[model samples]
Target: MVPKRKNSLGGGGAIPASAIVLGGGEGRRMGGNKLFLAVDGLLLLHCVLDRICPWFREVLLAVGPKDASSLSLLLEGRSWASPVRVVVDRAPGKGPLAGLVAGLREMDSPWAFLMGCDMPWIQEPLVRRMWALREREEGVLCWEREGYLEPLHAFYSRSCLPFAEEALARKDHKLKSFYPQVPVQVVPEEAFADLPGHRRSFEGINTPLQLERFRESR
Candidate 1:
């Protein structure tokens, strides 16, 4: 039971920000929709949602058209996520960046922590810690020395919507395509060395092998 959209959200514990969850992936690597896949009896999507719902006032889930109706049914009315909304990707198959564009437009917060449904290992405390680094940057992202960036596990401000739109218009769907236009704080991996399982925090379970390995590691 999806909650009705409210003009106001209940207060007390949730952070003022929102968590934007991107679950529009085709999941070809996982053989099908991976959101339904489970780890320890909990659906992967549920795992990710449960972890962040307590930390944010609202959460926006971006999904392709196919999952729209089903997801509405899946919510089962989690009151903690009272103001949650399921935003369908305007460009259905254009990938995560498309999902991102849709989310940004509907978001009600200045800061939205972006993440993927497949990435259930995200750590909220570490992410909250990164909030300070977002001082003047348009967003904050995790970057590796190997030239890899974990955009799915970063934070983006409402201000980035236009730049993201500009990139989408040019068919440049990569998240970094709009990077040069915005100031993004690129935090190095070393900064996360102190958090236990920090490396796994950005690990996405997009493939069966990765899921298997993750389960084995636990």
Candidate 2:
């Protein structure tokens, strides 16, 4: 495990870093809350939390209003490395942007790593590399694949709250809508070439077929 770094701002504080997992999707394609779907004897949401919790001071799960009850039940007896908090989306059905906003508001960290619950194959080394790359920057740091921005799997600074909120206010829930208003560093594919499974690191299981394939592969 990488040693936790102290916050560089001085004052004898630990690094104010946290992670947010967005599990509030309607799951229209999956026919149900995909996060609860089992994989390797554990729920998909638990798998994601277990992988990312160790890397941050706090990890928050943003779920839809209806999904909260079941999720709380699933977490009852589970143990996690970092403190885990469950946050209900303030604006349900507003898409990932709303979930992001909800998670950011609850986070005490100045920066947070954002991801979808369906993306169970997140690479820790790649995540750590992105953390290192954002050390001196004050914006979102994420990877770009085949001309598409992976906003859900990225690093966001709390400083971007205004832009995010503004986009939400305008009902423009697209995650990228607020990107133009903030400083963004798009990590290219080659940047993660040396990391194993880089190609699948950003993959998400959004449908039953994908989940079935993932299960079979595992």
TM-score of each: 0.84, 0.88
Reference-based TM-score, model 1:
0.84
Cα lDDT, model 2, residue 217: 78
lDDT leader:
2
lDDT assessment of candidate 1: 0.75
The runs of at least 3 residues in candidate 2 whose Cα sits more than 4 Å from the true structure, single-residue gaps closed, are 1-16
What are the RMSD figures for all models against the true structure? 7.8, 5.1
Q: Model 2: what TM-score?
A: 0.88
Give a tens-digit lDDT track for model 2, residues 1-86: 12233322123222358888988887888887776888778788887887777778898899888888888888998888888888
Clash list (residue pairs), candidate 1? none
Scored by TM-score, the top model is 2
